[model samples]
Target chain A: MLIKIKWILFVTVFFMMGISEQADPLPSWNNTNTKRNIINYVENAVNEKSPYYIPEEDRIATFDNDGTLVPEKPLIQILFSIEKVKEMAESDKSLLEKQPFKAIVTGDNEYLKTANEDEVISLTLKTLTNISERQLREEVKDFVFKTTYPHLNKTIDKIVYKPQIELIKYLQKNKFKVYICSGGTVDFMRGMSKELYGIDSENVIGSSNKYSYNEATGEMILEPELNSYNDGREKAANIALIIGKAPVISVGNVGAGGDIYMLRYSQNGNKNYKTLQVLINHDDDKREFKYGEKNNISLNWADKYKWNVVSMKNDWKEIF
Target chain B: MLIKIKWILFVTVFFMMGISEQADPLPSWNNTNTKRNIINYVENAVNEKSPYYIPEEDRIATFDNDGTLVPEKPLIQILFSIEKVKEMAESDKSLLEKQPFKAIVTGDNEYLKTANEDEVISLTLKTLTNISERQLREEVKDFVFKTTYPHLNKTIDKIVYKPQIELIKYLQKNKFKVYICSGGTVDFMRGMSKELYGIDSENVIGSSNKYSYNEATGEMILEPELNSYNDGREKAANIALIIGKAPVISVGNVGAGGDIYMLRYSQNGNKNYKTLQVLINHDDDKREFKYGEKNNISLNWADKYKWNVVSMKNDWKEIF
Candidate 1:
């Protein structure tokens, strides 16, 4: 009778605790307005009685990748290209004879800081990476696994913000279709999307390279040309074209005004459901890198639009 | 006691019948090798012990629209553009004065028959369609639900091939990710894909028009210019560039050499799983339209490649 009474008491206590406690959807987030706002928005969205109620199909979320999801300190794609350019220089020798390639090969760091997209494309296509996508994807996967960002000790995949990932999962749990809208090449991002962001390759929209298909071998050769450069206004346009739906929630970081258009596009006042727009303000140099565009256009836009600005120092309890 | 005995016997018989019977996946498809091949391939693919086992991530299946799913006749997109052109001409009066618009508006049947894509673009952009994608998509949905194809009394959505739809659903039931790599406009197709083929807007890859984003309102205005014309060789390239994974199963119809490249692309011998390539042949004039490319390019290629040539007359028990 004593043993049975003890077991009953334990079961009752456990049941009461289970019923009393509401689990945190975003545990990595600190108890700030940024966290509170996100939680409140999601709660209202899933509640049919709430005015902010969003149906499953309308819960579209678009996230910018490079700085928002991972550290973009000088952009990760450029680093990937630079590594390939150096490897090619050892064999070709003629690569060092070119302008952008020469700058990269000779360690002209000052020149590279101001290198244009055309120069970067030339470095990528002319020196390396115009082969079949299957082959290039293998190389990208190898690089991502082996790579460490400058001043960072962790592998590329581990550099993602813990709070942002929690937010993505929270939104997904409420039936949101989350898409990564990045300015990086779609081919490059697709190689790591499944592993890095828990996002499928098809759900990632990015800058694309024109491809040439070989009818005989059925090999898809990545052409030496830009099909679409997914950035700024183009990001929003690509979302409209590919996804064919306006995102109710958008997350981006401050950089070269790259995300302003996409953020503005999301909050464009067409939505029947209440929306959330998160701008990650990289102000914590101790935990993560501290940087923004020199012009401050994106931050200004975020301010003007009243989008939620997440301070890395205040909003996150942990940064991966 | 007699009633109880009868109930027991009935239950035993029903249990025996349920255990003995296996469901037919593609009922619209007659007992042919094509159906057998599809079933066998998917069975082996999902079976972990089989050599053809494909993981969920790698179970990619791509399908073509147009004649593959719905009748391409004069091409449904062209007909849609014609309808818009006619509507605009009625209000403006000046729209009937242009070259291709005049050709369409004046009912110059010969000119329209020979009208190329540029002429079609001129007719579409000049007369109409330089509006927001949201508004344009609404018009497309209205057309799909209300309008009928030429000589077909049914609405556009009702005219989809039942056998193909059955095949798509069968693939889905076996954990395959099915995508529609159509030559239609992505915006136009997104409007009716769910109703017509049970495809989501994001899963339908197609020809795209350049779009301009409205920063103030987030309205994506459909530009008059062509972005990517997803047909022929481009179909295969677009599949690679967008989906980023080689399809293990591809379904397309013979019209031009359009389906040939995509079919070949699917069977490129790069996968671990056994693949299925289906070439739909429109050789039943009595039940449906009978047509093939004049050059016989697609049929000859299918013969050379030894792909499954599904004769519309012999293979299908039903058309729609």
Candidate 2:
């Protein structure tokens, strides 16, 4: 009887050690404060007796797609628009007579660099629409799967920051429903969301064009109208209008003023769960890439709010 | 040994019968094709062996709030809007000088009775905005909880169509995520969705005003601008934009052209799980109200599509 009890204790201890060895949710992340903060937050969030415990229904975590999830110096959506414009110009040469369309088709974006909101919108409509949403999505699908990134020499899907994807899955495993809230078009991001990030189309939120559906064919056609161009304040506002609840974990990067408002929205006066704000800082040009916004607005918000900033060089042990 | 085996078999049969006896999901509906169709669709949807099996992630069900889920003679939202307008006038007598506001203040809606779309929108902006979304939601909450129905002699919450609530719960029991797609403002419906219909705020979708957030306070202030006024074809269009997936089951009513497009949106060329379209016909004037659209558009669509039309008096054995 004594021998059996001792053998049972030995096996249990070995089993626990084996389980812990395989339980690193973010293996790609270095043993830095960034990784520790995320794991600790999730652990406390799922603990029923913890003050930071969030009910499963309220555990929403939103992520910014470009810059945060993948490379954004040349946004994937921008490349998609360029290819679409080139396709349109091939059929109708008159499209090349315009400023932005001509600039895009001829590979000169000097005019686009200084374009105002209205000028940019005109280009978006010319390139992104005058077709059904289904067709636009198909075009994007082809581009993402076929095209290779310039410097990375790999497809966008194969190189979506390994650490971010792991973080999303980790949150999902702990009962958090993750959403992609980006400045990219809804259908544009949706084209690659499922296969790339394991997020379904239903959970992806972004800017979209107003649609007209055919009763006979049931295809939703995109019109030359802006539905909502989400960035900065629109990001938080649209979340209020759509998701109806404030997210508890909001992740973005410090490239621009892209995600400061969303992070603020998540942390603003939230008394339930201890909200987490993660700002990914690109600091490794050797491994991946490095850049910053024109202004220090995003970094300022991160500083004032005491947000966790993950340095790519120090915090990410791997880069896809 | 044979006698003991026979006793065990008898007990097993009795246990199977007890499970079936407790498995009636929709008890408020009388035996009819309406109830039968819903049960059949759910059964096949959840059964993996069936060709009509919808993967759990794709089991989205959207419900139109007015006339479909609850009463709509004097829509709950309309009543709430009127009360807000009145309160606004009482606070600032200057607001009573306008045409619609003046008419409303004097208890004479002569001007509003034939007001055009822009004029109605002007009123919507005035009553629904110039305040934070949170403040407007609080106002709606107060109105829904305190107001009494005119002829029903019961508060709206106390009488929300018991059969419809049962149907919602039944679908939820089978792993369907239900959402409220209503012409009412998202904030307006969100206020009472949980208490009255058992739907969370995040599951409610509706028209909304644009919002601007106060960086200091984090309050999302509603702007006078209309973000998306969802009605007619816009309902389906907005759903496609917001929800990103076409609903397999869409429920609406025939009171007006309020839901024909959404019903069509659900069934249009869907080759997946057998899509179900339900049109609740408010035929019982003694029990509920009776009404129809100006034209036969809704009923004609229902007839052409062979959508299930629930007769409020005949199909419902009970109403809340």
DockQ of each: 0.62, 0.68
Root mean square deviation (Cα) for candidate 1: 2.9
The candidate scoring highest on DockQ is 2
* Residue pair clashes in candidate 1: none
TM-score of each: 0.92, 0.92
lDDT by residue for model 2 (A1-320), tens: 99999999999999998887556889899988888888999999999998888999899999998778998756777767777788888999998898667778888756434333344345577667667776766667777888987678888777799999999989999999899998888888888898899998778888877788887888788888888887888898878888887899999987768789999999982545689999988889998788777888888889999899989999999977
Shift in Å, residue B164, candidate 2: 0.9
Per-residue alpha-carbon lDDT of candidate 2 for residues B185-287, written as tens digits (9 for 90 to 100): 7888888898888898878888778888776887788788888777778889888887777899999988768788898988982545589999998889888
Q: RMSD in angstroms, candidate 2?
A: 3.8
Instruction: Name the 10 consecutive residues with the lowest summed lDDT in model 2 chain B.
Output: B112-121
- After superposition, the stretches of candidate 1 with alpha carbons farther than 4 Å from their true spots are A1-22, A111-122, A125-128, B1-22, B108-128
